[model samples]
Target: MSWTDLTATDLVPLPVVLPLLAAGLALVFARRPRVQRVVSVVALAGVLAVGIALLVLTDDRTLVVDVGNWAAPIGIDLVADRLSALMVTVSSFVLLCVLLYSLAQGVSEEAEEETESIPVSIYHPTYLVLAAGVCNAFLAGDLFNLYVGFEILLAASYVLLTLGGTGERIRAGSIYVVVALLSSIVFLIAIALTYAATGTVNLAQLSERLPDVEPGTRLAIQLLLLLAFGIKAAMFPVSAWLPDSYPTAPAPVTAVFAGLLTKVGVYAILRTQTLLFPTDPRIDQGLMWVALLTMLVGILGAVAQDDIKRLLSFTLVSHIGYMLFGIALATQPGTAAAIFYVVHHITVQTALFLVVGLVELRGGSTSLDRLGGLAKLAPGLAILFFIPAMNLAGIPPLSGFLGKVGLVEDGVRTGGFLAYTLVVGSVVTSLLTLYAIVKAWNKAFWQEAPQEIETDARVPRGMVVPTGALVAFGLALTVFAGPLYSYADRAAAALRDGSYVEAVFPDGHDRGVGESNETIPKAGAPAGPASAVDTGEGTP
Candidate 1:
């Protein structure tokens, strides 16, 4: 933590800055598809390298960068620690995977329609920019910086979602765009309200000032923020926009969306709850109710879908509820469970979606009725789909199972009656999710092929590789869960203390999370003061 030690190689700025610069360069070669691919891919590789460096170099400590030499609370900043770094690592991996898949897709589709292909030039450039946006959001320190990062990603997604411009694509993309834009607008409004009410947008400053706000004011701010983020995270009633929109995109696009977008929303909620309002005797119960509803509702949707992609989309929404449930539990282990679950979900969900796309390619459609006999036709594809599907269903010996165990155990230990009921609901939802996957397998692989169409023989090897990469990568998490969980534990501890503390108080003081109530306030009105938001995943 010396001044000279904080170079560009330092943890704080490199992850976001490298991607931003690379994205700009990629856009320069936007007209040249091949060049754009190289620049973007190389840039994302750099991001992954930087992310690894960030994780290794931190040693469970915080790396704070005060932008332009400004002190905390006044200057914009970035913090790279275990939580942010873990997210950065996962996102970079997912981005690189999707980028490769997209390249393969461009080649495959271009070759197929050589006579009249729809010129997929914009995809490479836009995708790189989108990746940068996601990277920025994950690492941002201040609220407005987070907003900028979100806008960058969302705008890029709007175009990517509708890249094909087909009737179905256009319709789905429009809904996605409208919902996202409105959510962004609401987010902006909330920022304005918070800023006007308390003169700082830096998270740490608000963490200090938020407790002093009137009860009515705090509730208003909290509800607006939750509504905005709930929309983004696709939690419960707000999640309707995800299913119709996601499945309509290209395979790579869908994978990235499934992997990154809602998770970003979940990340946002994690920050807000831990840093801003950890628990309110009143507001938290409301959030818990929403959490339970979101989990049940999403799985129910998943069960009802006939199309493979659509079913996964609903599952995505359902899983978000689980993450929120961890957040709602407001305990160290619960939060840790959430952190583990987020990592597990990103890899499992993306791998599963990619496998579905491959299955569709080989079979011509992902509908339960259209897909059949794939287990015999392509054993490799089956293996790829089977592992991740089991993981997603939370089967044993997988990271998914471990993450759920952590969360459910935490809930029962500290959550009392509400916690136990929700735990039951969570278990049931997991079972339902398993049922949906089993149905898909039975219809697509176990059952015999109904009708024959010889034109598109097997899913190309290119598509297979990217997906296989994800599954193999996901399996690594299971194998290495111990160290990763330790890191996640450290990360959960750091984040709940408020990431931008120096920005809030330039003296650079530390509040020794859960011990200092003088500096960090709890959830209440202007007059009431509670304990610091309990952010560690398992801390009792």
Candidate 2:
């Protein structure tokens, strides 16, 4: 359908609806494995296309879909703007590629064996449900719907994490489920308190009302929300659960989780911090310290790892600090840099994990000691690993480098002691990430294989193609850095400007408009500089 024919509200729901419908179809065709694969892939691909369309259409405007045609504060609404659209689109593409890779590797086929622990018939359906949840979380316009979205994905993830039913997988699944459940409980409680305090769960309404709350109560709510999201984002001190949980799932499952799940939490933090709690010096400074420590501790953990998957997991946690660094800077450029890095990291990290899966297939293990001579055995896999690994390391001319540069430049421009310190920490973390990856490379691809280890047969083309595609996609981010950065800059600007709030509550009821102290620009208005200050107690 043409953009002229389809309104933003009409387009907003399709990304969530298509996968959910396909998931039901997948369940009905459970006995037909080929149909299941087709349904899952097509559903996700459709969502990806819809997300892209929404991104283009909503670049300059907000798309708000009120389910059941209900009005704001009482009805369920799905809002799509540039930020949500970008996240959903990029995540959908990653999910699709991972699905193709999983199918190619015959993971579902293997699961079908009576001897296997996971139910093969349920994989496709569950996967689609997970995708649906992800899109829902991205598009949700209310706190309750966002909470529901998290529960949906976490439920499906509990199933996916332990698919093989091996003791290791089961143990890992238990930890993941527990951590996820605990976070959900906290999130639900936060929702309850927010409603009790403000009498509305709609984000736009909350944005308008929350600032008027008592400072102590407001800070408490912000902390509760941050604590819940921090655990989900795998932030430091609360991040102990991630490395233990993620490495045990099947490669594709781990890849997608590593790529997208924590990011959803980061997205939540981004939305809430910019909208609900605009400028709290205390919270921003606290987050800065957390970011620095998360980076240091996570990369240190990675440096001590012997296995590639676990190593990547630690690095994954480490890089989240980079995004948090942007958030902590609380400036336009910093937020823009964080957005760019999120996109870069999602593709680069997912691709790296897929390459590790291939390494496992070729060398029989992901252990550095067990894996060697891969460059000679599977040159394509070596190249795949090399590209993303270098990108992840923040090597020059890659998207990772550009992202870091943006962040560092923001820090420099902001010129705070904490910001400057984080710049140094970020550089150190980048170098350490390179060291860890190079250690893996030297042992897995450069060094000679241990005679005791038996190398598997040639790597499958199915796996290689997807991995290479993601790697190429990451490079494309660099090749087209100008436009991509511009888009990210716009997204950050839109968010800081309160365009989302305007879109959700277009009637302008209680939006704090025309108040002398109001700092937030009206809907469709340009946001002021990040440095703009307002003494208005009621301003956002």
Candidate 3:
């Protein structure tokens, strides 16, 4: 379908618009927490529906919505092709589940009493705004708008991060805010440099113009963008902030941030690597090394953690290396594996955090030293935790295992010392992840309970239900791995084919005045060699 055919595709903007609108309405009803909760849940449910529709619609094509009738390379645009739509759908489902979990947990007595700092009334609205920001970032079609999306989510996150405003949370929030501000400032400077050099910040426009830039200048811009996004994605050397900041937040907040936030940064790297800087051997090699280090360092940290939340946070960083490993290969199977791994990791990681929240709810502490015998006290929670835990460790027949298998296969297929070394590192990381999670399991669920522990702590149905639902979803990804991987492969192909750019600029005007107005190759075309620039035009 053509761009004008978007008349039938108004659903493109609703994922972002609904939550933003609901956030405003929720704020107005903040005093009536019940009303605010209903509004926020309904809005997110609506977004979930829209996400599903967009995913189905864009499965074989692209859908672009130019905001306010503004044209491309100038106006804001929201584009949903296979990749973005899939991300939105998955993330929306995760957000809705976490929101349900939060509401189930209810406001703590301390939060209720600290009305000034906690502002219990604002939680629903701010949470919805956070959802809006995540949706915006995934759907964004240009650099400036993507930055806006980051700021929107980061602002909401700052509020969520310090929800109770206790001393510990405040301190954690302070560190988080400083790091986020630094990243944002760096991101903005990157935007300025990009626009100055290319005369446009629209990604499709950059795809055409960036190649004309001098090699040194292009590499500089590329590294700057990577540095900014790497911090956001919690890559090694920059990931120290995550373990410290995430564990202090309330469970639902931490879960959502853990699952979605870093992935957004990874998504940015995937998009820019393919669209803006498709084939640079040096960049590819650099990413491989970074992936190797992130895997090693992150998993080792997880191994040493006595706290379940912090351990999971470290594991979260470790698995990101798997995705980056695939991207660094810069091949179809590698990209496909990364996309599939992303879907797998988000669900499994978020589900694990939800289970951790449940553990804390029943056992009264996430500290492994204090908890024990949860298997006897809460069999349901034990089962819930066991499934995602094993999945996160890449245990057989689960989605995580499937994702890792794909990555390893791609690495071997790439066939070099670096790829082989990272492959080994990936295996070691997986084994270490298993060891850490099993250690938590033995301490928290299998071992004898301490006398001081509260055996009678209630497991509310609200909390159990969402956590169980997410676990089931993770299993569903495993059960349906064949189709999901196929979808990811197609999405990977589309990214390489530049179908997204064509969808945004259907008139081909953005390809520059003197350039040939050729369309991007179709999805099933033979993929080029790993070293060949997959930029359709083969300019490199």
Candidate 4:
């Protein structure tokens, strides 16, 4: 269970590095969007391969790749363990689908033949850069490095979010950009405070050193980080921005935003809670309340919406509460449920969005009140939407059921009044989620339109491929839950113990102990009382 050291083969940088470089090349090839698509897909495929390889190589090892050959606690490094590798791998695939969906865009050509040129011709390249940034954030081992990754993608997202520069998109994006900037500033201030307190930015190093620090100071830093990340995760009170801005973007862009972006915020929270503040008592008493409220508020928002994408966006916000519920448990099964749900949500959410996009293309709008009877028109599109919506609502014989059952089981197993409240909230949210999806289906696909929903343009085969792939992945998660569970369990095991933190920096706090990065992946993952594995070893 003790993994001593890890090296490049173990900590391959392809997930981050390949995308980073390819983003620039994609920009270079923007004159030919098809070529840019090819380059981006190639880059993402590389990331996917490396991510899978790294997962196998990082059984128990904390794979670290020190940038510029500098030692930890002084120079920056990248940490690849079970959780990050899983996130990055999934992100790469999502971005790949986004790019593919983008390629078949006819709006550009449709507008090109008109008088004014479409302003957002650069969307493809910028989107790839944003993917690069997401990868960077997941792989980053240091807080500062994470900030850099965050900013990189945030900048690109602002561009992609406001692609058309329409007065409406600009107005919506203006608010989005400002709110996002303010949150980024909040994160920066917290990072500065942490660095001032510890004189270090490496998370692995902070994990090992923060315990000696005063509890009051640690709590302050933790709250600041939470506020910053919470806003981004769209958790309840700070989540209103998501429905407003996300629904305004073009369908493909919205799909990726739904599938990948908010999850980044949740991912940061998971890392912070598990790695930085695992032993905090308030997690049980107060955090549970936030999770419960988040789920309720989000699902409530979903029920009130008639726009399919907007409804899904609100539901996405609520679904995040499920992940946090697992995290609050701070147990192996709890974290494993969080991990499994992350993957399931990614595929299911993306497919639904892509289906919405397809509906938009065929029926010309996603509002249920304005559209109807699409199932009779395009049975194929109906099939795609049905599978994911049913899955999203946690129907049986699907991956969503597995994920929902895991969280519910974890909540019930950690029995108490608070656990009971969360368990009840989970059931209520699941029912509400089903009601919202069924509303969309009955009104948009099953019910008749007001004698207007009609379009002769075919949903192109190219446009269908990416969305179909997403649906297939969702079902595969159901059929292949075994291997997926094994990986999720391993990821949970690695997150459970501090074996990964130790392997990344073998000498621990002291730097001159002649430590060499080793190629051996940790033979076994570490396990302990999740509450007992505190990593706060930094300066007070």
Identify the superior model by TM-score, candidate 1 or candidate 3. 3
Residue-wise lDDT of candidate 1 within 1-540, one digit each (tens)? 224344422556766777678767766765676777788788888888888876665553445565775545566667665677789988999889888887876742542353244454556657777877887888777789999988988888987887756788789988998998998899999999998888778777788788999878877888888888889899978888899999988888899899899999899888888888876857767777888899899999899989999999999998898898888888778888899999999999999988888887788888998878888888888899999999999999899899989889988897577888889988999999999999999988889878873544767677778888899988999999999888777777776665335323433353322433233232210111111122323321
Model 1 lDDT at residue 414: 75
Of candidates 3 and 1, the better by lDDT: 3
Q: Between prediction 3 and prediction 4, which has the larger TM-score?
A: 3
Residue 475 of model 4: what lDDT? Answer: 92
10 residues in a row with least lDDT, candidate 2: 528-537
| Candidate 4, 205-276: lDDT as tens digits | 677667877888887888888888888888867888988888887778889989998889889998888887
- Show the colliding residue pairs in model 4: 207-535, 208-537, 209-537, 209-538, 210-536, 210-537, 210-538, 211-536, 211-537
User: lDDT per model, in order?
Assistant: 0.78, 0.87, 0.86, 0.78
Per-prediction count of colliding residue pairs?
10, 0, 0, 9
The runs of at least 3 residues in candidate 1 whose Cα sits more than 4 Å from the true structure, single-residue gaps closed, are 1-4, 8-11, 107-119, 453-456, 498-506, 509-540
420: Cα error in model 4, Å: 0.6
Candidate 3 on 1-540: residue-level lDDT in tens?
334333335788898999999999987886788888899889999999999987776775676776876656667778787889999999999999998988888843336676565566778888888998999999898999999999998899998898877889899999999998999988998999898898889987899899999899899889988988898999988999999999999898899999999999999999899889999999999999999999999999999999999999999999989999999999989999999999998998999999999899888899999999999888988999999999999999899999999999999989999999999999999999999999999999999976567867898899999999999999999999999999898888888787777666664457444454333433422211100112232111
Cα lDDT tens digits for candidate 2, 1-540: 234424545778888899999999988997888899888988988998898887777776776776876656666888888899999999999999999999988876665573454567878988998999999999998999999999999999988888867788889999999999999999988998898888888898899899888888889899999999999999998999999999988899999999999999999999999988889999999999999999999999999999999999999999999999999999889999999999999999999989888888778898887878888887878899999999999999999999999999999998879989999999999999999999999999999988545545877888888888999999999999999999999889888786677666554455333333222434333221111111111222
- Total backbone clashes of candidate 4, pairs 3 or more residues apart or in separate chains: 9
